[model samples]
Target chain A: MSELELQNKKAAAFVSTETIDGEIATLNLGPTHPATHGIFQNILQVDGERILSAEQTVGYIHRAFEKLAERRPYNQIAPITDRLNYCSSPINNMGWHMTVEKLIGAEMPKRVDYMRVIVMELARIADHLVCNSVIGVDTGALTGFTYMFQEREKIYDIYEEICGARLTTNVGRIGGFDRDFNKEFITKLRAFLKEFPKKFDEFGALLERNRIFMDRTIGAGPISAERALSYSFAGPNLRAAGVDYDVRVMKPYSSYQDFDFNIPVGNDGDTYDRFMVRQQEIRESLKIIHQALENMPQGDYHADIPSFYLPPKEEVYSSMEALIYHFKIVMGETPIPQGEVYHSVEGGNGELGYYLVSDGGRTPYRLHFRRPCFIYYQAYPEMITGSLLSDAILTMSSMNVIAGELDA
Target chain B: MSEFATKIKDSILEKYNNTSYELDTYGEHNFICSKNDIHAVVEFLKNEGFIFLTDLTGSHYPESEGAEFQVVYHIHNLAENVRFRLKVDLAQNDLHVPTLTDLFAGANWMERETFDFFGIIFEGHPNLTRILNVDDMDYHPMKKEYALEDETRTDKDDTFFGR
Candidate 1:
C-alpha cells in the first residue's frame, strides 16, 4: 500500500462506518468550563458518558509565589502567603509567621497561641464549608450550598472583626498577632459558636443520608489508603482514606496540643467519606474554638521584638528608636539569622509547610511552600480515569483543589 | 539527630565511602548527599520506613561553584512521626539528576516544576516539559540571575516603590 493509503486505513479503523456513531470522543474540559471551579484544564477521553482517560493541565493561575517570597522581607512575606489557599487565608498567614518564628527560635506566649488557634479554627470552618457546599451544588443540590454559604459569611465577619480584611486576611505578625482580639470579636465568635452547630447539623442532615446524595457519592472516586499515602495526601483527604494522620495531632504547633479533638477517618475513601470527614471536622473545629475562647490567656498579643514587629504608629512618629526600627523594617533591613527551618501546620486542606532558608539577610534566600492541594490534585487524573464525566466534577469539588494554592 | 536518622547516616557513610556528603541539622535532620548517590540514598531511606515523600523541590545557588543547583527531598515515617530532608547538589554545567518517578509517582509534576523553574533536568522523566511556565520561554525564571519583578513596566518606577 502507498504511505498515504496506509495512513488513511489506520485512521479509518478508529472510525469505521459501523462504529462511527459509537466512536470514542475527546472532550476538552477547558479552563473556561463552569464545572471546573477554578482555572484549570482537563482533557478527557470519553466513551459515551464514561471517561476513559484524563489529562490535567494546571498553571493557568501561576503567580510564582516562591520567587516573590525570596525578594520580600520576612514580615512582608506574610501578605504573600495570604494569597495562597485564600479560602483559609488566615491559616496561611499564621503558618508563614510560625515558619519564620521557627527559623528565629522565637517562642510565642500562651495567649498569643490561643488566639491563633481560634482564628485558625475559624478559617478551617470557612474552608470546609465552601468545599462541602460546593460538593452539594455539583451534585445538583443547590439549596444546601446557599444555606451553608451564609455560615461562611458569618465566619468571614468574624475574620473581619479580627483583621480588617475578610477573604485574604493578612492577620498575624511574625511572633504573634498584630492586635488583641477585641470585645466585639469575642461577642461575634460567641454568637457563631452558639448558632453554627445547629445550621451545620441541618446541612449535614440534608445530604449525609439522603438516598440520592449517597448514591451519587458513596463509592465515587475511591482511592485506597496505600495509593493516597503514596501521593502524599494530607488533611481531610488522607483521613478519609483511614490513615488517621493529622498534622495538628502528630506534630502540634501553636498550642494545638492543648486542645482536645478527634481526627475523623472513613473506610471507603470516596467522595462521601471526604464530605463526612469534613463535616465531622467542622464539629471538632467548633469544639476547639470553644475551648480556646474559654481558656483565653492574659498576655500581649504580639511579641516584644521591636526589630521584627512594627511599633504602634503613634510611637513610630514620636520615638526616635521606634522610627528607626520602623524604617529598618519597612526598608527590609531587619537582620535574620543564618539558618533553615521547615514548619508544617494543619491547614484547612492538609499539611501546609513553609521551608525557609535564610542567609542572615533581610529576606529569605529560598522559601518553598509545600501546598497540599498542589500535591493532591496530581492524583485527580488517576482517581477519575474510570469514573463518569459527572462524577469527575463531584470528585474535583470533593478534593477542593483551590487554584490559588495549586498554582502558587 | 534522632536514632533513625543516625542509622541512615551511618548506612550512607558505610555504603558510599568515596562520595562526599554532609549532615546538617536546623529544624529537621538534613542529609546532604553527593549528586550521583541521591537515587540510591533515597531508595535506601524508602526501605528504612521513610515511606512518604512529603515534598520535592529545587533551589539555585549562583555563587556556589561546581554545585549551583540543589534538589531537596522531604520524606516522613508516619509510624515514628519523624521527618527528614535529603539534599543532592548538582553542578551548573551538568544539571542532570536521575528521576524519582519510578519510586514515587507523585514526583512526576514536581520534577517537571523543578525543571520548569530551575532548568534542572530529570534524566528519565516520562514527560519532561515545562509545567507552570509557557513552553516557548527560553530561560529558567527561578534562577538567581533573573529579576524578581518585570523590568519592562514603565508605570511603577524603582524609587516610587522604595527599591
Candidate 2:
C-alpha cells in the first residue's frame, strides 16, 4: 500500500484560482537560479507579475578575502585580488601591485606603465564583452552571448600568453610585470585588437538598437544622477547615470594621463544606458590600447628594485645574492615603511580600492578592499522595486555585480 | 596640497579650535578628528563639495592603547578632482560612531561591512546586521585577536613555525 501510494503521488499540487486573492506572494529569486548568474537571493514581495519590494540576501560565497590578506605577504595578496572581480582580474592584480608600489614609493618605467595600460585595457574589454553579451542573454538573445564569448576567449588567450594563466590572472608583480611582453602575447593582442572591433560591432547591432532589446532594457530599473552619487555609484554604472568621475581620468594612475580618451556618459541610468555605456567604453579601451601600443617605449620591463623584484630562477640557484633575494621575496624580509595608503583603479565594474595600514610588518596590519560590486548591489532592491520580474534579472546583469567581488 | 585642500584644513582647524584635530598629509590630506567631532567634520567636508563618499572602512589596532579602532572615510570632490580622508578613533570599550547614511546613501552597506568585520557599531544604521558573514556568528573575524591559523590543527605546531 505504501509503494502504490508513493507511485501515484503527483509531482506538484496546485491551489485553485479561487484561493488566489490580492495577497502578496513572497518569491525567492535565487540561491541557485539560472538568471541570477551568481549566488544572489532576493525575497520579493510580489503582486502577481509586479514586484512590490525585494529584500536581497547576499554573502552566499563569502571567502573572507580581507581577513586572508592580513595573513599573506604583500606579494602573495595579488592572487587574492585576482579572485575579486574575476571577470577582469588583471585590473585587480595591477591595482594591488600599484598599491604596494605607492607604499614603497617605487617608480615604474614608462614601458612598464604602457604595458600595464595595455593589459588593463584588455581586461576592461573582456569585462565589458561579458557584461554586454550577458545582458543580451538575459533579454532572451542567447546567440550574442554564445557568439561573443569566443571573442572574450581570445582576450583570455592573450592573458595566458602573458602569465600562463587565464581567468584569475596574477599577471604583474609589485613594481612591474614579472617579465616583458613576449612576442606571442603581442601578436595575439594585435590579432585580437584587429578582429575585436568588427565582431564587437556586430554584437552591438544585435542588441544595441534592436526593438526587443530596447523595450526590455530602456525604462527598466533606472536611478537618477543625484541618487547614484549619493549611493557612490562608480565606473560605468555611475557614468551611465551622467557623472563623469573616472578614477583613471581623475587620478591618472599608471600613465593613464598620457592617453586621451572620452568618457561615455548616458542620460538615463537605466539598464539600457548601463549596457550602452559599457559598449562605448570597450571602444574607448580599444583606443587607449592602440595609443599605448603605438607609443610603447623602449626600456626595462620592471623597475630595478634590488630588494623587491626577484632574480632569475637559474641565477637563484647559481649565485648567493640571488638566493638571498629570493628568500627576501618569498619570506618578505624587506623593511616596509609604516604608513597608510589608499590606492584605487577603475575596475571592470567600478572603483576597486585597497586601503592598507602598516606597522612596518611583513604583512599588512589591516587591509580593506573597497569592492565596487558590493556598493552597486546594495542599490538593487531600491532599483527593482516596482519593475516586472523579468526586468529585475536584466537589472542585475546590467549592473554587472559579480558575486565573488560582492561577497569578498 | 591644492588651495581648496588647504582651505579645508584651515576651516576645520579654525572651526574645531582643538589640539586633537590633526591634519596629517601621509597619502591624502587626512583630517584626523576625535570620534566626538566626526559627524560635524564629515558634514563640513560634504558641504565643501567633497560629497562623493568613495569608501568607508575600519582598521583594528589592539596594541595601540585607548584607541583600538579607527574608522576611515575617503571622500572625493568630483568637480575639483580633490580627495581627502577623515579619520575618527574610538577606544575598544566603546566602538560606536554616528552613522553617515544621512549624508551618503552608500554609507549604509559600507558601515554594515565595517560593523561585520570590526564590531564598530554605526549608531543610527537602519539595519546594522552582518553583510558578508553569516548571521548569528558571534565573533568579528577582522580584529587582531582572531588569529588566522587553525588553532586545532596538530600538525602545524606554533613552536615549530617560530610563532
Q: For residues A248-359, could you state the per-residue lDDT of candidate 1 as single tens digits?
A: 9988999899999999999988999999999999999999999998898888998878888889999998999999999988888877889888889999899999888998
Candidate 1 off by > 4 Å: A1-21, B18-25, B150-163
lDDT tens digits, residue span B44-149, model 1: 8788888888889999989899989999999998887778788888999999999898778778888888899999999877788898888799999989999887
Off by over 4 Å in 2: A1-21, B19-27, B157-163
* CA lDDT, candidate 1, residue B101: 83
| Candidate 2 residue-wise lDDT at A286 | 97
- Candidate 1 at residue A176, lDDT? 87
Task: State candidate 2's DockQ.
Answer: 0.49
